[model samples]
Target: MFGDGEHDDGPRVHQQRSEGPGGQSAQQHQTHLDSIFMLLEENIVTFVKNELKKIQTVLTSDYPECLESQREDEEVLDGEDEEQRSSREAFLNISLHFLRSMKQEELAERLQSSKSI
Candidate 1:
């Protein structure tokens, strides 16, 4: 999913910052991660709000319960917001992958401490 014009340069291009003292604690770290996910969902919701206006125009007066049934005559839009969920998953995956890759032993120790909770 990297888009056009996207570049990582190199892993060393950007130094990862250690989370603050609050994130050092198990409960606080979970809370920090939750907050990040919440923000990402909020942003996705905002995007959906904008997109909905365009979808409404395309959907016109008639709406169908089933997407498959509508596909032949109308544009089938996903009623359930899946983009937000995918965005959150992508964010978490990237964060965890980076932590596990470069900081291997350190990340393992931290995750082990938090796993019980």
Candidate 2:
């Protein structure tokens, strides 16, 4: 009864290699996996852009004034608001504006690149 089944491991191995799922080969399965990876990468980049926009709206808002007032002694707001703070306030505001603008430009470039690809 067991004689035919125990003939050898060669044909069993060959059969396994030649069949997958309903019987697609290994190369066909790899193409599907590659496409899934590309789609996932695209989704992650989109999520980052949306989250950054939300944060940008909050940071550049008048909420900074209220937030700064609370941290007056901690130096967190040491030179943030111009009319209220010292001479350094204007420079700080300008510096923050430049940095934010640079970040936005970089984000735009990345989004454009992703779309182009």
Residue-level error in angstroms, candidate 2, position 39 = 0.6
Give the RMSD in angstroms, all C-alphas superposed, for model 1.
Answer: 24.6
* Worst 10-residue lDDT window, candidate 2: 108-117
> How would you encode candidate 2's per-residue C-alpha lDDT over 1-117 as one tens digit per residue?
566667544556645675455677877777777898999899856855643443343343346664443344336434446654443334334434665577866544443333111
Across 11-82, the per-residue lDDT of candidate 1 in tens digits comes to: 772465456665475567878889999999998778656444433333332445433443532333333358
Query: lDDT per model, in order?
Result: 0.52, 0.50
Count of residue pairs whose backbone atoms collide, per candidate: 0, 0
Residue 10, model 2: lDDT of 57
Candidate with top TM-score is 2
> TM-score, each model?
0.30, 0.37
